[model samples]
Target: MKQAKRKKLKKTHAPTLWIGLFMMGLLVVLAVLAPVICPYDPLEQNLAEFLKAPGAKHLFGTDQLGRDLFTRTLYAARTDLWIMVMAEIAPFIIGISLGMAAGYFGGAIDWLVGMASDTFIAFPFYLLVIVIAFASGAGSHGIFITYLLVGWLIYCKVARGQSAALKNSEWIAAAKILGYSNIRILFCELLPNIIPQAIVLLMTDMVGLLVIIVTLGYLGIGISPPTPDWGTMISEGQTFMTSAWWLSVLPGMFVVYTGVALSFIGDGLADRFR
Candidate 1:
């Protein structure tokens, strides 16, 4: 019975995992190779070709500024994905470490961590992000600062729960009895166990983060001009939605595609880890 159950689980998750990996990997490769393969400079403009529809010359058509939409889209992928990964690094590390410490030490440490996370959770997530971003000023700096302030809360919560549960386990008590230092037990024992769940959360969290970035760009507080962000592109194209719908639609589609890919990854990982 157990063997059959294990096999069923494997069959269900394995395909989803592989499909997501393939889709995401293809996008990454294309973005990385954008400079080499792109026919035109993403930022270059030609008044003559402005608003030209998709054709042999311009595969995805030209925007209002006469820049190649295809090129800009690729470049946008590069910018957004890079920012997404970089923005998460600090929060991931700090959140996991703090969560582990709080759970392992308990008492004062746990209380403080709980208070901080709860405080952040009290407000609407996007509201906090927008306010912070507006105050911090535009571009990547604002985005990073906004994330740093709030992004760690989810990770901290997840890690804290896992650590707390594990702390009372027999193995944890055995480690204590065996003279393992608190630091060593927290990092060496607890971290390895908790990291898998955190990674699963990371996949889904990235999708949300990407959406936030696009929203910021749409609102004129992200990436800035000439940077080829999807949100900014959508905002710019909205004026011509009737005449040249591709401008807004194409970028929006890519955002959905990327989000779907990440969602698959998160779901698959969750199933696998379970």
Candidate 2:
């Protein structure tokens, strides 16, 4: 009876994991096949092909510059995937380390780490990112770097909480009593336990990155044009929105759909993690 109930519970929960996996797989496929699968040269501009609607030749249509929206959209996925990935990485490392230290040490180190995270959490996250991006003016790399500075604070807090929670656990106490080092427990035990929450956070943040990259481009602080960013495509398309609504709208839809799908997956994972 116990085994049967356990099996049933597992079956019920399986779909959520599957859905998250499927969405992530879709994102990967889009990113990898972007170049070859796209219909036209993303960077190729033709005044003649400019502002063409979805039709026999062009599926997503062309922008005002006659660049293929279809191709740009695909490549744009590449941008979105990596920026969020980078954003997560930058903060994950520092935050996790500080959090683990703070949680384990529980003194001045904790205070210092808490202060830093609070400072960032105090910032209007997006606004700070924009300011940093413009100040550095390092283009895409700069944008990612700047956001990383802001994005990791949440992770720090999560890690700190997890660390604090675990410090009281029997196994952690047992390790300490057994003369096991703090560093050993920190990496081997606490780190692994906290990662599920981090993964859930990563997935949710990945969805938001699509919009963030586009917004930066919209603000003229992200990757520039002729490079085939979806944000750039939208920016270019807006001028022709009355005459060539497809130009801006198509790419926008692609961004939104993928992002929403990812968000669904993220939220499900987060719930399961809880």
What are the per-residue Cα lDDT tens digits for candidate 2 across 104-220? 788899999988887878888788878888788836886677767876776788899889888999999899899988899999889999988888777776666667888888777
lDDT of 2 at 24: 69
Residue 204 of model 2 has an lDDT of: 74
**Candidate 2: count of backbone clashes, pairs at least 3 residues apart or interchain:** 0
Cα RMSDs, all models: 1.3, 2.2
Give the runs in model 2 whose Cα sits over 4 Å from its true position: 1-12, 271-274
Number of backbone collisions per candidate: 0, 0
Runs off by more than 4 Å, candidate 1: 1-5
Clashing residue pairs for model 1: none
